[model samples]
Target: GNLNERKFLSTLVKENEVIVDMFAGIGYFSLPIAKHSKPKIIYSIELNLESFKFLTENIKINRLDNIIIPINGDSKTEVIKLSKSGVRAQLSFLVLY
Candidate 1:
């Protein structure tokens, strides 16, 4: 299991913001990002279909149906829209675990 990094990251999350999980990996961090943070839009990208499916199911299982958006694609290509949309809006925090 991994430690919760988003608890601190959420301090930087704001309304009208975009977040990109450069490597979403089963939504380990993205799920919490939606639950404990502001209601900003999130874009989670996963390369593995199995993991992406679980990631979507995790969101549903957690009942976080409205906030975290899961995408099954490469982060490098998939995140362009999110980045252009404004994920880099604020680099206020960077918590890694």
Candidate 2:
């Protein structure tokens, strides 16, 4: 069931308990992780409004709005929010292109 998923993410984030999808493409990966792994938090970032819209819709479709945090902007900049909480989100897994 989680065979493929565990392989893909485990490689990059091997030890990263917390993961971040730098480029949340329609929530292809973010939604899955949030749905399966059920991590503490998933920050889905998308610069394009169209992409962001799709991501948001996907999150709703999967009912993961509570688990996945949709950031409608560049992940590089919006990542600051994770720190606003005083360093609670020390992400170890980062998904990029």
Candidate 3:
């Protein structure tokens, strides 16, 4: 069985706070954050095209289009670009699987 970290992470999020998820595979963690935390915005970057596609679809399926912005690229580069573009997040987390 997979360890469910949803409750812990969800509790860490604050309303109107911004979040950056470096490896949001299939929205596994992002979905819970967006849906449960109700953050102002979440920048979810997934490098793998297949995973990115699922991330995008899951956002719609969960009705989190406005909250989660999916970026299909390497998380490192995307995060650099986001910073250059002035997108800031209150919290950032990286997941490796």
Candidate 4:
């Protein structure tokens, strides 16, 4: 379907890279990216409660708990906290989808 872009982007992620996925909807792109790329850490921020719930469930189902961190709230505020959390790794990408 619409996985071409996601598939391509996943190839760009390197080891120990950090990612901040804004507007992550039910781990659609994030899951594929995480599964394929295996970044050091990914902060997936979702605003919709239902979607956020699914996001967490998906992460768990995929056993990516140590890699993908699910944030249930507005990306606008959560991004700031993540940026200030002393995550010293270089950001590999900011997935806006």
lDDT of each: 0.71, 0.69, 0.88, 0.82
lDDT of 3 by residue, 1-97 (tens): 1436876788899999989999888987889888778799999989999999999999999899999999999988999999999988889987555
lDDT of 2 by residue, 8-86 (tens): 7634432335566777768777776675564767777788899999999999998888878888887777777766755
Mark the 10 consecutive residues where model 3 has the least summed lDDT. 1-10
Per-residue lDDT for 1-97 in model 4, tens only?
4799879878878877888888887987779888998688888889999999999999999999999999898878887787798755455344543
Give the candidates in order of TM-score, highest first: 3, 4, 1, 2
Residue 87 CA displacement from its true place in model 3, Å: 1.3
Q: Count the backbone clashes (under 3 Å) in each candidate.
A: 0, 0, 0, 0
Task: State the lDDT of candidate 1 residue by residue for 1-97, as single tens digits.
Answer: 5454557666567766667765677777777777777756677788899999999999999988688788888767776766676566343222355
Q: How many backbone clashes does candidate 3 have?
A: 0
The C-alpha TM-scores of every prediction are 0.75, 0.72, 0.92, 0.86
TM-score of 2: 0.72
Q: What TM-score does candidate 4 reach? A: 0.86
Residue 85 of model 1, lDDT score: 66
lDDT: worst 10-residue window of model 2: 10-19
Of the candidates shown, which would achieve the greatest lDDT relative to the real structure? 3
